[model samples]
Target: METGERRTATERTWMFPPVTGWTFDQVKDLEVPFDWELVDGVVVVRGETALWHNHVRGALVSVLRAAETGPYAAVSGQCVMVDEHNVVKPDLIVCDPRGLDVFEVECAPVEKVALAVEVVSPTSRQADRVRKPALFSANKVPYYWRVELDRDQKLAVHEYWLNADTLTYFPAPSHPVHQHKLITELPFPVEIDLDSLVGF
Candidate 1:
């Protein structure tokens, strides 16, 4: 029994070895349990999501899905190919419905995505707060939202819209943060009541 238990643990612990200088194709071919992103030829494995992460993500996805009218659809944990060597999976993504398949095994083109949302987890703070926004803006993703859980466990939404000329994000000229609700016109009109949405 002890030997069998040890073998089981070892088998579960075995994972695809991380590689440097990998392209999107190489990363995609890897059969790992965790989602992966190719960041400038380096493979970054996504951390396991926690309960609160899913709770916040579910709330946002529900709102976005309900508001979906035409052409646009919202999804969670879909990969977006930024370039030949960059693929990222946002927590929630809103994009052309035609671009996604039933299972979402294939990555959606960055150009087709209207909004990319990241719900910050303890391990994902730096990447979500800094790296992803820059990458999304550089790819002209048009809209970006960062959801944060405050000390009091209330959700705070940070909104940004890409500046076409500069290819960077600027706070939506309207309400940008923690206004109890978000009302924006770009990527089509969207109004969400944050307090109620998060059940806070």
Candidate 2:
């Protein structure tokens, strides 16, 4: 390694003030400069998402926002407190916002969230597929969706519903893989044209 070599932002490690006894309430109150989430009561900072990921999220959010009827609305990047120790921020959340201002909500209760969505990125494949779904299922989030982009950039959507008896996610009646259209009615009636989501 050369002393003069420059490191990219992603290559550099950023540190926050060292502290212990980090609770969700305490961590939420602290003034932090970057995006972070609570995993087992520890603060894990996240890297910025890629543009293609953003394209899928924004496009899908727009579709959900329009498809959702009455009290429901698609809210992006909201924190759902999984428990006392785990707090996860899903790419999108759908909930009834009849009483409160959804925009002003920083930490949303799992009971209030009807559905959670995640757009898979290269760096987050493991978390998106395994950890996030487990957390959401354990917390009893009613519905969950995982969006993926294949090698040719064709979109794929995976849908799941919570099994109350088991407290885990069960696959939807059908799974429409690569470049297929997804039409579902559990959480809400939404016909998702997977190809339409990945324009970039």
Candidate 3:
């Protein structure tokens, strides 16, 4: 008979926000769960963010909807994928219209996305700065944005690409942190203001 708390090795489950690894059938079997991202076969649930984080998130959504005008679509805190075990929920996502397949009823594939962004929540900063970039680069994602909320008592912006090993951030000589955008070669080019996004 089982004893000592009856420990059992449970197979881990993985997912990329909104859509989980469980098929519709598997999902139906689950009674309770929260949003999560599976990276390197490890499942990591998104941590609850600060009010400032939420404020920045909502602000970005608003800016994308109201100020930045273009054919692109902006998504907030939606889980996306780089691979089966590598899933992420970006604070804000700006994608090319061509990548809409990922947002379909069935959801899009990993490579379909053009850009992925992460807002630096007190809890998520390390994963964003260290873990995600390598995964994104390995997957050949063209662009990535990292928003830092704790530096100098103000918001800081950073951007990366698969081509470079290190990340280049905002407050650029030509573009201030607020003026940066995630530009791409897609037919309908779209950009987001980093400063305005996190509410500087």
Best by lDDT: 1
Those runs of model 1 whose alpha carbons end farther than 4 Å from true positions after fitting are 1-20, 99-105
Between candidates 2 and 3, the one scoring higher on TM-score is: 2
* Ranking of all candidate structures by their TM-score, best first: 2, 1, 3
Q: Per-residue lDDT tens digits of candidate 2, residues 1-200?
A: 22212211122322322233245764666455778877876677766888889988998899988898877878898888777567788899998766666567667878788999999888778988999888888888888889888888788888888999898998876653424688888688888887877765
Better of 2 and 3 by lDDT: 2
CA lDDT of each candidate? 0.77, 0.76, 0.56
Q: Which of 1 and 3 is ahead in lDDT?
A: 1
Query: Compared with the true structure, what per-residue lDDT tens digits does model 3 show for residues 1-200?
Result: 32222222133332332332333222223333565565554456678877777887787667565544465567786666555445577777765556365545333345765666678777787888878766666666666667776554466656555554443322223332433444433223346555555454
Best by TM-score: 2
RMSD of 1: 6.7
How far out, in Å, is residue 80 in model 1?
0.2
